[model samples]
Target chain A: MNLTILGCYAATPRTFTNPTSQVLEIRNRLFLIDCGEGTQVQLRKNKIKFSAINHIFISHLHGDHFYGLIGLISTFNLLNRNNDLTVYGPKGIQEIIKLQLKLSNSWPQYDLHFVELTSTESEIIFEDDKVIVKTIPLKHRVYTNGFLFQEKIKERKLNVNAVQNYEIETCYFQNIKSGKDITLEDGRVIPNSELTFDPEAPKSYAFCSDTMYNEEIIPIIKNVDVLYHETTFLESEVELAKKTMHSTAKEAARIALQANCKQLILGHYSTRYESIKLFKEEAQTIFENAVLGDDGKVFEL
Target chain B: MNLTILGCYAATPRTFTNPTSQVLEIRNRLFLIDCGEGTQVQLRKNKIKFSAINHIFISHLHGDHFYGLIGLISTFNLLNRNNDLTVYGPKGIQEIIKLQLKLSNSWPQYDLHFVELTSTESEIIFEDDKVIVKTIPLKHRVYTNGFLFQEKIKERKLNVNAVQNYEIETCYFQNIKSGKDITLEDGRVIPNSELTFDPEAPKSYAFCSDTMYNEEIIPIIKNVDVLYHETTFLESEVELAKKTMHSTAKEAARIALQANCKQLILGHYSTRYESIKLFKEEAQTIFENAVLGDDGKVFEL
Candidate 1:
């Protein structure tokens, strides 16, 4: 799985800083998350195919999280998109989008669907054969959800050399990969363990942002491959972070440490900071393997 | 008066090209005309102070014209803006903006006002002591208005040397500047023309865009110092222009010629054209003083 950081700043977008938005590539599917202003331009700059995105996951209704959504939706219609697209977001999102489209008199020619979220509890919102996305209830100024995307476990791999020792026919290869014993023509049976090996373990990624220090989410995101959490402030501005219901770098690291994720990615820095180095430094002091999330940076897990 | 072109392309924004938006500086006031996506960033890149802009004019309800407005408004609130802001646009604009703000729950601390337009005939929409803005009804696929920003007639300049020669009190100087004859204590009347020189003639700028080849607006914008018109196509694509309710470069020049404006600006070119030079060449065929409008290019009138 790979993730592209399109924007990482908080509150407002400056000349060089953008607001929160990113693209996640998992199992050959492209998903857009938290589209801030200028995200469409960032997509063009990054050369990401617009049509490749069939699903959008929005964490909340804040302007920084979804202001660019309507424009992107309008551009899709302009581009003659006829494919089905679904947006999963908080309850009010459907009203906001439909209102603009209604007033503009330019509704999408294709089917547009919305999976509105009202439950404050964690729940699975999207699932495919390859992956399942579940909401991680987060504490913020508003009702919010952080997504946990987990790839489904794969089938067992055939031990090609070990299978050769048996008189297994080509038609029985499916049974071998399915972790089942294959019986020979003379009624002698071979154990499935001798013919197949376990596939690589499935990986998962947890995305959390714009939330305060909440210990309840640790259990939901614990032991994920990568946990990306918002670090809106450094240790020096802990008070501001608390007042805004945002997490400081130290707080995010504490969550990461408690959650015991393999890797921690820190992002969504306030524009007041001159550099993002302090976020990494502060986050790493509490949790090792903490990396700064910068715009245009890509991370693979 | 100064005019700065922010983005002048037609339809949608590209990686390097932007949609329609511009800034007009007149009488120490800055007015934003049409705010496409990324306009706030363009304002910052152009070094235009956001606080200095109290009035915004949106020509239409199309996404290209006003998609950036909510983000800019939210940014203004984030910057702690307390000054009042006024927006003038089509009838449905207020509803669209209000809906988004309601969903985001971010009401502006500053006073926000809207002037909705639905008339098909020309009318004065905004007026102050130094300038007046009127709507120039244009034919388009949607309801659109072209703005005519005309500076109010300036006061006559005082001849400092000529004024000192008379025994006129400082309080009477206002009367002299108002073009009234002054009377000395001895009842000797001095002609105002002899004591003062006429100030420079008031200059006006007419912005017409996203319109077809309609002659109805020629009289309303006639004899303006500068006329900026949208030329969405070349003469070769006149049929496309007619179908889209957009004008060709040649048609824009024909309007400039018929309106008898001092200068003509051709902009809003379709991205299909590789070079912008062709627009100027085609426009100059009908109007001698046609100039190409480019993003970031400033004009003084």
Candidate 2:
């Protein structure tokens, strides 16, 4: 799995800084997250093909989180896209998109689908043969959800040496990869473990943004390979973080540590800060593997 | 009057090239016209203060023409704007803005007023002592209106020598500046034209975009100081212009020549063009005073 941060900031898009938006590539599927204003421009700058985006996941309806959605959709139409697109977001997201399109008198030539999510509990939102997407309910000023993208384990690898020693037929190799034991022609049964090795463990990534420090999501996102959490404030601004329903750098680190995630990515830094490097220092005090999220930065997980 | 081209291209906004949007500063009031996406960022880049913009005029509901409006308004709210904002657009514009604000639960803290226009005929949409804004109906795929911003005739300048020659009383100076004939204390009648010259001839600027080569508007926009017309295509692509309800550079120049506008500004070039200088060259062939519209280029009239 690979993640590219198209934009990672709070409030508004500046000439040099962008708001919250990113692209996650898992199992050959490119999924867009958040899509703040200027996202399409950033996507172009990042050299990502427009047609590669099929699924868009919005955490909330805030302008910084979702304003670029309508523009991107309109751009898709102008590009004459015919591929089906799916959008998953909060309840009112669909209404905003449809209203804008209606006013513009423009409609997509593709099948545009909307999946409005309102549940505050963790639930699966998307699934395919290669990947599974689930929601990590978060606490924020508005209704919000974090997304967890997990890859599915593939077929077990076959041990060619073990298969040859067992004198198994070539047609039975599929059974061994499916974790089935093969019966020899001499009336002897060989264990499937001897013939096949387990596939690589599935990797998972959890994105938690615009949320306060909530421990309830730890169980749902436990042991994720990477966790992207919004650190809108520093440790000194704990009260401000609480008032705004945002997490401080240390608080985000605490959550990442408690969830046992391998690495923590901190972003959505407030413009009030003189520098964003302080976030990395503060988060690293609690979680050793903390990386600051920067626009156009891609991480391979 | 000063005009700043924020974005003047057809189709989607690119990394360096923006779509349709511009700022017209007249009478100490900054008016935003046709706010495409990424306009706010452009405003920041141009160092135009957001609070100075109290009025926004959207030409049409096309995404390239008006997509940046909501984001700008939302940014105004985030900046804690207290000044009222007025928007003039087509009939459904208010509903679209209100619906998006409602869905996000983020309404403006200031007074937001909308003047919905459904008129196909020329009519004044905004009027103040210093300026008058009227809609210039245009033909497009959607309902579109260009704007004509004309400065109201200012107070006549006082010619001290002429006033003294007629022995006009100091108290009558105000009346003379207001274009009223003054009867001197010596019972001498002096014409107002002798007392003062016209105030800069009341400079006018007409913005006619996203329209065909319709000559019916020549009467309304006749003899304007400056006219910014959309030249979406070159002379070679006249057929495409006719089919898309757009105007080519030659056609735009034809309208300018017929209306006797002081200067013809060509803009809204289609992305298919390899170079924009061709538009200026093509337009200059028919109209001598033709200028090209480029993003961030300011024209003082």
Candidate 3:
């Protein structure tokens, strides 16, 4: 799995720094997260294929989070997109998008679907054969949800030596990979474990942003391979962070530490700070495996 | 009068080329015209003060024309703007803006006003002491209008040497500047023309974009000092331009020539072209004072 940071700044987009937006590549599928105002341009700059994105997840209805949705949808229509596109966001997102499309008279030719989320409980919102996505209810000034993506268990791999020793038939290979025991031609039973090796461990990633320092999400994102949390402020601006329903770097690190995440990625920095190194330093003081999420930075998980 | 090209391409914003947007400065007042996506960031990059823009004119409801408006307004609120802002656009623009603001829950602290226009005829939309703005109705796929920014006739110059010879009192200077004949204490009446010289001729600029090659706007924009016209196609794509309701460089030049404009600025170029010089070359074939409108390029009219 890999993640590309298109934009990671907060509140408003600047000339050098963009607002919140990123692209996650999991199991050969690309998912867009939190499209800010200049996200489409950032996507172009990052060289990510626009058609590769089939799903977009918006954390909230704030301008910095979802203002680019309409423009993106319009551009998709202009590009003659034929595949279906799905957007998962707050309840009012559908109205905002539909209204703009109607007024602009540029409705998409492809099927555009909106899955409005209002549940405060963690629930599965997307599920496919290889992966599943669940909502991590977050505390913010508005109704918000962070997404958790987890890969499903893969099929068992064949142990070539063990299969040859057991003299397994080619026709029985499918059953053996499905964890089924094989019956030999001489009426002897062979355990599946003897012929096959265990599957690779599944990986998981959770994205949380534009939220306050709330520990309620720990259970939903516990022990994930990678946890990306918003750190809109430093410890010095803790009071401002609280008032704005944003988290400081130290607070995000504390959550990452308590949740037992393997690695923590810090982002959504306020433009007031001249350097993003401060966020990584503060986060690392609490969690050793913390890294700063700068624009155009890619991480292999 | 000064005009700044913030963005001048057509259809969609790209990595290097932006969509339609510009800033017109007349008599010390700034007017934002056609705010496409990333316009706020473009404004910052161009060093234009956001607070100086009190009025915004949106030509149509297309995404490329006004997608950045909501984000700009939200940014204004974030910056704690206290001055009033007025937007003039098509009839449905108010609904589109108000719905987004309501969903985002970020109403501005400043007074936000919208002037909805539904008239098909050319009419004055804004008038102040120094300048007047009129809607130059154009032919487009949607309801669209071009803006004409014209400086009002200035007061006659005092002709400092003539005033001193006449021994004009300071109290009557204002009247003299207002083009009134002055009466001395000895009951001698001096003609206003003898005391003052004629004021500099007023300058005018017309912005026509996202429209076809229609001659209906000639009367409205005739003899303007500067005319910025959309040139979305070259001569080879004339049929496509006709079908898309856009203008070619040759056609834009034809209109400028017929209208007798002092100078023609060509913009709204399609990204398919490798060079913008072709537009100026084609336009200059018919209009000698034709120029290309490039992003970040300023023009003194």
Give candidate 3's iRMS in Å, 1 decimal: 0.8
Model 2 regions lying over 4 Å from their true place: B165-167
Q: Would you list the rank order by lDDT, best first? A: 3, 2, 1
Per-residue accuracy of model 3 over A89-149 as CA lDDT, tens digit each:
9998999899888877788999999999999999999999999999999999889999999
What TM-score would candidate 3 get against the native?
0.98
- The TM-score obtained for chain B by all candidates, in the order given, is 0.97, 0.97, 0.98
Colliding residue pairs in candidate 2:
none
- Give the alpha carbon lDDT tens digit for every residue of A73-141 in model 2: 999998999899999999988888898787777888898999999999999999999999999999987
User: What TM-score would you report for chain A in candidate 1?
Assistant: 0.97
> Model 3, B198-291: lDDT tens per residue?
9999999999998999999999999998999999999899999999999999999999999999999999999888899999999888899999
Q: A183, model 2: CA deviation in Å?
A: 1.0
lDDT score of residue A39 within candidate 2:
95
- Each prediction's DockQ? 0.72, 0.79, 0.82
Tens digits of per-residue lDDT for model 1, A231-266? 999888888888989999999999989989999999
Better of 2 and 3 by DockQ: 3
Please tell me how candidate 1 rates in CAPRI terms: medium
